[model samples]
Target: MFDDTFCLNVRFLLNTQFKMIELPDNIAALQSYKPGKAVEDIFEGKNFDRTAILSSNENNLGTSPKAVAAIQEAATNSYLYPDPSGMKLRQKLAAKHNTTIDKIIIGNGSDGILSNIFKAFFRPGDELVSSAGSFVAVNVMTKLNNIPYKQAPLTKEYAFDLEAILDLVGPRTKAVYLCNPNNPTGAMISNRALKAFIEKIPEHILIIVDEAYAEFAASLSSEFPDATQIELPNVITLRTFSKAFGLAGVRLGYGVGSQFIVDTLMKVKLTFNPSIIAQAAGGAALDDAAFMQETIEMNKKGLAYYYKNFSQMQLNYVPSFGNFVMLDMSTEERAMYVFNQLLNRGVFVRPLAFFQLPHCLRITVGLPEECQLLVEKMAEVMTLEKN
Candidate 1:
């Protein structure tokens, strides 16, 4: 018995030693981003021929024809290194935003720009302020840097409670992150409220406004906030091509701010961070104004359909200004159960327990057909639970 136990102990120690690779304290301790399951991972051996992924808020219209053609034309040049400055793309985007190219710095995605923003301004023990129920990336970034961030509670309506946010700010607060037309709940902070909040905040604190879903918010103009023209010294707005521009696979995004802030971030930004193809695709995507218009119109229709269905089913949902909506499940567990069942039916949506919103799920607006399939599958799943 002693011999057998000693042999087992030796094998266990050998395995542990092999697997215990050393890593940076922060990198080793970090809780990584939990990505949504890919279609292949969910249906590897199953007979599913078609899967509808509404989990990630991506453009369903596919890539713009002009962008696709540009990519094909540029394919031959892939062997050579791309322009480090990405000047042409920057010029075009600057023109689109009514700002000089110097005011924009492109990155892998809005998330990349966000990380740069954090790194440029944040350090250990610095405090960051954000809404309690927000995108997971905010928490991930804060924890990774060992920065202190307080989650200001949203109002009963799930909108940004500007007063609560201001109340939490202190001397250590280096930055505040906000998802204008916030994720999961889709509640937005209005321009008037933002202006008021800005007035109250200390000038030293930087405000990072992530507008990944801004095109959709613009479509809901009357209900959504006017984010285009809030000139503040410390405010930075991040936008991405992954959503309305249909360039998720290409992963391109940029941030718009005063030249001072832009230039400061550029100092720390990875040289040639945005890939050649991504920059080219982003520039081409912006040029396709007609495609963008169609996408806006379709998203409006899909959101309307979602609201009508929610009302018909007597389900409680947070009114959305973005391309997604949050439905209140009886419990977070129930929401998760429904999420799994939706997966079984080849429909994917997001669960928001990470944001402390356990009773809700974030469903992205898809094409009409995809939305219909999702609603039908949801109905079936809920009915089965009732039984």
Candidate 2:
């Protein structure tokens, strides 16, 4: 409708308006979470056939056979939108948890569901409490939602400091986030401690128990607490098929809570998430008991190997209940040196500095060959460091 001069003027005005729109203060202050590097990323400069990505705590055994099959079948129906409610997957999850479907909440992943929880439930002046070095995602989520996050230091054993956390729970606190078999450290609170902590929390405070690695922890430790089994109306138990189920690529996770809480979360959740293939994969993965057992057995063996190798090398390491272990490198500088050396050797691991653990690094338990490679590379690096 206008000539070239008018068009140029309009373009300049639009650009100026767009530039003036700034991110919210909270989001502006956020530091992006650093994820594990891909095999390609680590080996980009150098060409090497051997590579092990023990970074993201993914299952090294590949995708679940049952889930792979389901994914393939679902791909044929990709033209249709995913079920808004994710009914079939919810039904399966509810059955597994021995709860009704209304109590179940599914999302793109446990992290996705966690973000939705913040949006739906968290409000200004609402403080969230947790352990200091627990999960970095919680740190990100709190800032993302502008929720006031308070934390107590971890216990000497690296488990959640229940007493300290409870002491920090003030009248302004609305929720507590606990990551059992916590990420990076893989430390878990015993069943008794978990129960005691829950009882101490005020009834109005929502306790979120994120058991992402619960299946592995339960398999490895008799003392592991399954929070979903507690059946508390105020407690929300979140689990994911991403880890032990070997469905990380599919990104399926769920939460078990009261029906009212589920409804509230549903209102904020994306209408169509965890697409058709993901939902189908999740449903099938639940039935793959043999695969789960294999994952656990492999994880057990891999962890033992890492512990033994680390011990022989005189490196301090945390005994893990999950599929990964944390190695204390004595200082942030040492940790970064180890990380860079491993990266050069085509072995990618995660640095825990951002997890408030600057002196440690996390390594996922890979397959037998991969584990051996990691040990060999670590030995070489440490030997060189000493020299």
Candidate 3:
């Protein structure tokens, strides 16, 4: 009996030991991406009656009425599984872009599509080259997947250094990511510069142009290149309903690329990645051209308000093509101090330390009232700092 009991105990110990698992070194070493703080979380216990969430560059004008109706209609059919292929949404997206459905790929969001691209095209040691201080997702995903990443510094005016980025592209570089109307700093590359840069890139390396803020950029500048209009074999343009469509909560986005690249990305994408409701909402949003125009107009007005105020105050800010502007505080400490003060005043703006622009704070263009409040709070904060 004693021998049998000891043998069972030994087996249990061996099984437990075998079950212990270690994550890959790359994943184990990764620092997770931090999204903008939620309004509720930030304002908890604060006595402020009003809050302007200007941290995330969301469409404050709200979701399209048509999208809302579509989402409501789709709710009743939630019992059925979503179409894994996302055919209908792809059809709508293709029609909108004047392309075939075969060249379109949809995912949970642009971020998910980006992940699939990284997984499908890159190997463990392959490199991704992108602008320094651009979107954080590319950096996060590369580190998480054990892929090497190289960053080319932004120009002195906070625009993409296209020549520097081209210099960084080497033989093992699998992809180049260009976040047009770049985040944190809403600076953009003109059509001429972008076209030249694309032409100079090697055919083997894929160019992934992330145009999350493309609509706003296009409205602000006639020179902004619409990647969809560019017929490069190596280029993939990513767009999302999260911005202008105001469907961020719906989590729908797509990639337009060559048939070959789309096919490969489909293999890595999660089945039924975007739900039926998200698909329906995206289709409806595309049709709601009036809502999109209204959102753009509101953003333009808000940006104009900010420009006037910043100019009057003599505070330096990037002339933004996107819906957000970055204010330079002259020092990281000052930026942090202003961020905290703004938070206390019930205003939320993004601090840029994480993006390595330590002395800057990114403020999304909010509603007219919110924009006024943001400017007022900034003025107050600067005054307090001066004292």
Candidate 4:
């Protein structure tokens, strides 16, 4: 009996190797999107004398004074839960846009709202359609839900090829995604083009237009699409406080759509989708139109500063409507090398490999001095490369 027991134990021990199972198929198969490197990560073993992070396309103008004051006033009430309905902020948003409160639905960020939308609308066999080289989060969310995704290639000028995207849609297509003044490239769809495109799409398939960078574009051009113009039942427009409002850390974003779409999103959104502090800050930011205008003016000046430097360096870049611009590197390796060099120097700019444009880097428009410093550092790097 002892011998038999020993043999059984040995067999059980040996079986450990065979019992190692494969990882779950869902998350394992999904592509992970690389976000901007945190400022803390650049410190290494010792703190740098000067460090600035412009990688994430964040508002360079610091958070609004009014919003900061609002946060301070609300600090004592942190123990209490935020209102789940977000009624106050929704009402304010509606008043600003000349719409009803029920038409707005707030979320943790636009990304959260998007994920919830995918979960609420998509099924295992449904197909997701989006422009190639757009935001990586959309692709990740689609795969997480086991939805098949189809990429509609952009035009040579990096504009949304609406016709190409429409051609890809069929019975299985559930949603279409767009990042107007699109990330990395900063190309935008004209208002007329977008309106015509939406008119062609069926009511059942959703058209998600991400206007995260819309405020910056609003100041620069009037040709971009506005939510008020899109009256289609299929259209949903997204905006965020993380951009022009200088509240990236606060995580406030909202979706404006038909009442049916807003209701559908609320069904999947968590209780207290936005924190009280975030709501307060967002509302205050909206009230501070002067701050927003100053930010817009600074961005325009900074953009010009960078373009002048680009001209002198003879570096090619995509003309931008957003707060950032993409410079093309002859090879992906060179772009990555410049990214690493800048990070070591305590300036962080984003590499574009995550967005599938491996030979480019996206640099946010910072303060005038910051822009000058970035140009000086880039010039130094380029000179070194030639030697």
lDDT (tens digit, per residue) of candidate 2 on 1-387: 799988779989887543467899999898775687645476776786788989888888988889899999999999999999999999988889898999999999899999998998877899999998877989998998999999999877777888888999998998999999899789988899999888888788899999999999999999998888777778888898889988887888999998878999999998999799999999999999989999999999999999999999999998888999999899999999999999888898999988999989999999999999999999999999999
lDDT of 2 at 33: 56
> Between prediction 1 and prediction 3, which has the larger TM-score?
3
**Which of candidates 3 and 4 reaches a greater TM-score?**
3
Q: Worst lDDT window (10 residues) for model 4? A: 15-24
**In terms of TM-score, which candidate is stronger, 1 or 4?**
4
Q: What is the full ranking by lDDT, best candidate first?
A: 2, 3, 4, 1
Query: How many clashes in candidate 2?
Result: 0
Off by over 4 Å in 3: 1-20, 32-37
Task: Report every candidate's CA lDDT.
Answer: 0.83, 0.90, 0.90, 0.85
Segments of candidate 1 deviating more than 4 angstroms: 1-25, 32-37, 48-50, 226-228
User: Any residue pairs clashing in model 1, and if so which?
Assistant: none
Q: Write model 4 residue lDDT over 57-161, tens digit each, in one string.
A: 988888999989988876778888998999989999888778888789899988889988897888778898878888878777777787888998878877778
**lDDT: which is higher, 1 or 3?**
3
- Model 2 ranges off by over 4 Å: 1-19, 32-39
Put down candidate 1 lDDT per residue, 1-387, tens digits, no spaces: 669889779889887543577887877788666898564486567676666788778888889998898888778778877777778988987787887888878888989888888888886678999888888888888777778889889888887787888888888899888888888788888777777777888878998888888988988876455443566778888888999999999889988887888888888878877877887788789889999998998889988898898887777889888888889887988889989998898888888888788888888898889889888888898689879
Q: Once model 1 is optimally superposed onto the true structure by TM-score, how far is the C-alpha of residue 131 displaced, in angstroms?
A: 0.9
